[model samples]
Target: MSTGITPSLFHILESKIGKRVLVVLDRSFGFEGVLATVSQNPPGIWLSDAEAVTLRSTLGNPYPQVTNRQDKSELFINLSHVLRVEILH
Candidate 1:
């Protein structure tokens, strides 16, 4: 699996550290949190106070809802599993 750390993605992720973002995974799982770190050696994203959101599957469904409360303050997500990243204002 590709780490998904393209030059642009890396730059964008790096810049978003310490900021809020919505990370979308391959299976439509989402995480909304403050970006803690972006590792290049073993490409991954670390999120602080992250909330896992399960995306809606059927039409006319409600918006994604927070499904998992992260036990740890920091969450490390492998870049290979990241499908999309959206920086929040």
Candidate 2:
């Protein structure tokens, strides 16, 4: 957690297009996937499964993992529910 001036989440997300990221929601849940697109009007992130990343649990931390289900191909996450976003290389 750097104390540098953080940019808007939207701009940060926009810059992550086509990259893998871990998005933590306010509810203590999160997912790892490739950022496909960003919506402004409604505010959401579209994640694709093409280059999906799986969440791993360590120690007692129960990290949410993405499954290979039919409906798991794409995920739409509301920006309002996002608490933090971490870019993965």
Candidate 3:
């Protein structure tokens, strides 16, 4: 959880609030959406307008395919499964 930087994980995630982010987790499962809130009780994040992303390798495809999960408007990500979070522009 320690990134060797001065800022902690909570601070890092906090800085990303109100922005679009791509949160990558275990088994190539990712969530793409806007950061809605951060909580300590469950140590997770809530994403608004969220989409479940599945990263699959394809022949000759350099980029992974992204999916928009309209069925899931919001998602809660457990920090334990999180690998990294990419702040989207």
Compare the candidates by lDDT and give the number of the best one. 3
In order, the Cα lDDT scores of the candidates are 0.77, 0.69, 0.78
What TM-score does candidate 2 get on C-alpha atoms?
Answer: 0.63
lDDT of 1 by residue, 19-46 (tens): 8888889455778889998888688889
Give per-residue CA lDDT, model 3, range 1-89, as digits (tens).
54333337788888889999888885457888999998765688999998888776577976555643444688898877788788999
lDDT of 1: 0.77
Alpha-carbon runs more than 4 Å astray in model 1: 1-4, 57-72
User: Can you write out model 2's per-residue Cα lDDT over 6-70, one digit (the tens) per residue?
Assistant: 34867977887999877777343576678999987667889887333344555677665543223
* TM-score ranking, high to low: 3, 1, 2
Give each model a TM-score. Answer: 0.74, 0.63, 0.74
Using lDDT, rank the candidates from best to worst.
Answer: 3, 1, 2
Q: Which model scores highest in TM-score? A: 3
RMSD (CA, angstroms), candidate 1 = 3.0
RMSD for each of the candidates: 3.0, 6.4, 3.6
User: Per-residue lDDT for 56 in model 2?
Assistant: 50
Q: Candidate 2, which ten residues in sequence have the lowest lDDT sum? A: 63-72
Give the Cα RMSD of candidate 2: 6.4
